[model samples]
Target: MNMERRGFPVWSIVAIVLIILGAITAGLSIETVPEGSRGVVTKWGKVTGRTLGPGMNFLNPIGVDVISVNVRTRKFEQIEEAATKDQQDVQATVVVAYHPEPQRVGQIYTDHGLDYEAKLVTPGVTESIKVATAHYSAEQLVTQRAQASDEISKIITAKLAANGIIADSVNLINYQFSADYTKAIEDKVAAEQLAKTEEMRVRIVTAQAEQAVVAAKGEAEAIALMAKALADAPDVLKLKQIEMMREKWDGIMPRVVGADGMSLLMTTGE
Candidate 1:
């Protein structure tokens, strides 16, 4: 019985040692905060008011909660269908680039929680798209889509900044209209193209007519210049007459047929 009692004390000491070792192990447990991320730690259901950065971080094993917020840039795509100023239904697909301010991440988490995508980002994007698009007509939306996208981006950035989120840029990925509207736009574009083609053809014909007049003027001026030159130099006229005679005669003697009893003979090389 004494031996058994002594063994009991030893077992008690072993169990105590194991318990102490377990407690130490638990206390030594640490988490790593990745680069470009901030760790928010809460103690006993209250935020600790301190943010942890990259590397191993210690926290209370029992009552502390550590939440990691990524400081890197993130992209979100938002799609919405809304009515334009002209009451035309359009679908807008937008992509937004954003990043949480590293210094403000803790506050953002506290205020927005983990589900900021549903609570803040999406709503902001949708609202901005709807509001900005509402100011433009369907034709304007199609033709000046870039301007509409810029306006929407500006509004979204401003709104997100107000809520502690930093938006880098918003891009309109695609804008689609109803099939009937698309067909109408295509037809209108075709008509405009046809009108432009007709205008171009008319311009071409007018240009051709002007060219013809200019060419005729040039020919008349050339003829007057030739006459002036020939009048100034009578030898030029004789040389031209000799060239014409050589071309008209083939070195044959001239033959004359008279019908009015008057005969005139012209000899070659005369």
Candidate 2:
């Protein structure tokens, strides 16, 4: 009876211990990495230069730790107030889309933790905004917003890429100035437009006056030509006098005075 009891309890204990051991072994040998993420294995807080891809991965869990890093594209957005070359205060929203290089995941995690955005991208963005804004005046910044955005993108992207981060795109979403500045710009534009209208009116008046002078000169030239033609042929003057008399005569008979001092009745129509 004692042998039976001892054997049964011993076997039960062995089975229980085997189950626990099996669970521990399974836990240590197996790991799962989620999509859009990569895992870096480390030993004693030191990276082992090994990285694991997404899905089920086997690892030596007893002496190793896997740090899962998000290799997916991430975005950082910030609104910053900066000064232009003209000393105008401008506000801009900067957006940066970045991701860690998949092959450099281990190096990235070892060098900078998952909080790399705060450490690297933020400063790069801030500095880029300042550098870009300083090169243009307030008016230029507003007028050439696209160019300014491109410049900001170049500076930030170059800086981030040097630090092992891939910046896909950087953008200046919104660029604006103070309300007072906008109002001033509007007023200045209005004044300029008014000046242009007035100048156009003046030009029109001047052109009309020039046309009148040209017409007067044309009439004077016609009179001079007529006088010259009369002087060139004295008979033309007599013919013109006869034409005037014929136009003035009506049905009444006109008296014709001859050079011999004799008067005759001239009939216009029989």
Candidate 3:
């Protein structure tokens, strides 16, 4: 009876041990890739070049590991400093949207590992922005912001593509300049406005001066014309004298005469 009981107990222990090993093996062999993610398979601490899509992935349980990488669009912001073409220091906040090429996730893992943003995207963005900023002056950066962003996006796209990342967009969010530079720009705008105002005032004064000169010329011309008309006709002077005599003489003539016996015209009251 003791022998039979011992034999049954040993079989039971063996079964239990086998079950545990099977469970452990299944746990290591089966990997579930979450939605919007890809699994990178590595064997013996080396990339196996096998990429698993979303769902259950089965692999050799021995000497195998799987890493999940998100393939969805993600954004990261970076504040970087660069010098403009005119040697002005500008601080820019840049936002980058990107995603791992789903098919190339394995390559990305091979090249940059899971920390793709830090190793791959970040350096590309920094270099591209610096290159682009160096092509524009401080004022051109503000005025031609769209062109600058496009150039940055193009440069970064090419850079990240070489490393298995797809760059969706690169945007320049904000720009910060030194206080002295900002104040200088403000002062320049103010001076330009003041100059425009002064120019308008000068134009108005010149117009008024021209009008005054025309008015004076017209008055002088009218007076000269009247003097010329009188000088051209001697009969006009004689007519003026006759009209004055008629106005002063009444119906009666003067009886007193001078020594030469010439009659003097006079009014009745005189």
Candidate 4:
């Protein structure tokens, strides 16, 4: 009697197992990189210096690993305290926007790894802020804030460039000082305003006094000139009196007493 075979041939079972293993190996060899991102490929925990762009890429699945690195711009914000040029303590809100150089991402990963922001970017930004803040006084930091931000950006740009990072922008959003310094600034401004008001009042009073003196001098000169004219001609006074009488006289003539005590009628011709 022929013995019933318990299962299929041994070769068939081995073929099925081989097929499943191949399918798993094929799946492991493929890697999909998303947009705005780059895959850093490594072999046996060693950097391969080969970057993969978006889409599927095939590589040896046995010892190769892929690390996704985002190439898009990223923001880093922190509040930093620094000393100003005038030895004043100040705090600033520092924001730095940066991104890794796409072509040099492999080198960046090799040097800085995944914690590049913490290791390189943060220290670079912090040091740049301190360096820039040292150039300006606390008051200038507030008044020339745009200038300060530009300086910080330039510093960070140079600092990060060595590490394969492109610093896009740097912003100094807010500034704070000690309470005593703030009060001192306020008091100084108030004093300046008060002084300006006093200066204006003094100028107005001086102008008024000068005008009064000019008027008095003009009146005195006129009186002196009239006295000289009268002394040169005594009959000028009598002419003046006659002119005044004519202005007040009616059409009728008036009777007056002459030096000899005789009554006489005074009349003026038209």
Highest lDDT, which number? 4
Superposed by TM-score, candidate 3 places the C-alpha of residue 34 at a distance from the truth, in angstroms, of 1.2
Between which residue pairs do clashes occur in model 3? none
Tens-digit lDDT track of model 3 for 61-160: 7888888999999997999899999999999898989999999999888877889999998998899889989999887777688988888779889998
Candidate ranking (TM-score, best to worst):
1, 4, 2, 3
TM-score of each: 0.69, 0.64, 0.61, 0.66
Query: What digit string (tens of lDDT, one per residue) describes model 1 on residues 1-270?
Result: 575666656677778999999878876558789998899888786777789999998775788778888878899996788889999999999888998777877788888877777788888888888899999998888778789988988999998888778998788888899899988887887898899999999999999999999999999999999999999999999999989979997887776878987767866463
lDDT of 1 at 172: 87
State which candidate has the highest TM-score.
1
CA lDDT, every prediction? 0.85, 0.87, 0.87, 0.89
- lDDT minimum window of 10 residues, candidate 4: 1-10
Q: Judged by TM-score relative to the true structure, which candidate is superior, 2 or 3?
A: 2
Candidate 3 accuracy as TM-score:
0.61
lDDT by residue (116-226, candidate 2, tens digit) is: 888888887888799889999887787687888888899888988888889988878998788999888778778988999999999999999999999999999999999
Winner on TM-score between 1 and 3 is: 1
List candidate 2 segments past 4 Å from native: 1-28, 60-62, 193-270
Q: Number of clashing residue pairs in every model?
A: 0, 0, 0, 0
TM-score of 1: 0.69
Which candidate do you rate higher for lDDT, 2 or 4?
4
